[model samples]
Target: MNAIELSHVSTAKPVLLGDSLTELEVMRDVSLSVPEGEILALIGPSGSGKSTLLRMINRMEDPTSGRIFLFGSDIANLDVKELRRRVGMVSQTPALLPGDVADNIAYGPNLRGEPCNPGDYLEHVGLERELLRRPASALSVGQQQRMCIARALANHPDVLLLDEPTSALDRTASRNIVELILRLNEKLGLTVIIVTHVMEHAQALATRVAMLVGGSLIEQGPAVDFFESPATETGRKFLRGELAEDGR
Candidate 1:
């Protein structure tokens, strides 16, 4: 089953007012899909709407004119609250709640009235059980990031959306998190969609890579192919590091 399916998805067009103040058009006719249990990376330069696309997938933002399906159901027609519960997201800066680790991890399940064992999730993320009582702010950056991931997993989400999850981490920490994500995908069959500016990181974690530029999807294919044979000029330039100063 396809975990996510999008067809002709588009954001709102800019509306010009009487005074000629123009609204910015963020996303174009964006469309993509990820099969169940596959890890796909959404790659692009900053402001390319990769994050916007991720948000749309989980209904954090509604598309102006498009359809999104998750787990075989049209997300537009599903209950907003329930749909979110099944799709978890983690961003670059770990948004750990102001509470102990256990409480933070259990927050989602608690809200849903679902039975939760924060310890189980912590273990799944390779954290110690004793850290449950630690305050979220007390852990090192890497540890805190892992805690955030564990918190997301506490809900047993079917699809996980990650947005530049390792941007702030050191090389070692970033590697660890990447390995953990791969392990989670392999062991639990989690369908993961990651948005990343770092091409190397995307290559390391993704089974497939989708490149976006100027709010357009340039190309998407297996990880190896995306790196070796980018189909679009934008992708080729990006892979060659020709757009480094421009942040592409």
Candidate 2:
């Protein structure tokens, strides 16, 4: 079964200037599916609504039209907190709470009146157990990112949505994160949808790739096939660096 599915989804927001109102289209008729336990990468130029698309899956942003489903059930029918617990999201920057790593990791479960051992979650993300007591802010950017992942994992999510996860890291740190993502997918069978502008990272981590341009899905296919020969002109130009300037 598909882990997540979007059918004719579209989003638009109204903008007002003086007495006039204009609608800004964020995504246009985006239909896509992510199979169970698949790692799908979303690539696009800036302003293509990749992050917005990710947010819609977890209802952080609702679509103006059409529907979204998770594991064969309409997400709209699920409780908001339950839906979020099933789909966890991590942003480009770590949004660690102001406290020790242990508290941050336990925050999610505590809200639901469940037990959580920070060290166990930390280990899932490859962090040392000793770091659990340390201030969350004391860790390096990469470590903080891993801690964020651990915190998300504490909720026992089945799917993970990552938006520009490695954008702020150095080459080494980025590589580590890529490896970690691969490990999590292989070990836990978690479905993942990651938004990234880095072609190399996408090529390395994604089994399937989806490309968006101007808020429309232009091409999507196996990573190897799409990288070797894109089906669309815009996708080809994007690969040739013609649209690189517009990428984040």
Estimate the overall C-alpha local distance difference test score of candidate 1.
0.87
Clashing pairs in 1: none
Candidate 1 lDDT over 50-136, as tens digits, reads 898999998888888878999779998898888888999998899889789999999999997889999999999999999999999
What TM value does model 1 have? 0.93
* lDDT (10s digit) by residue, model 2, range 158-208: 999999999888999999999999999999999999999899989998988
After the best TM-score superposition of candidate 1, give how far the Cα of residue 49 lies from its true spot, in angstroms: 0.5
Stretches of candidate 1 off by over 4 Å are: 13-21, 244-248
The best candidate in terms of lDDT:
2
Error of 2 at 34 (Å): 0.6
What TM-score should be assigned to candidate 2?
A: 0.95
TM-score of each: 0.93, 0.95
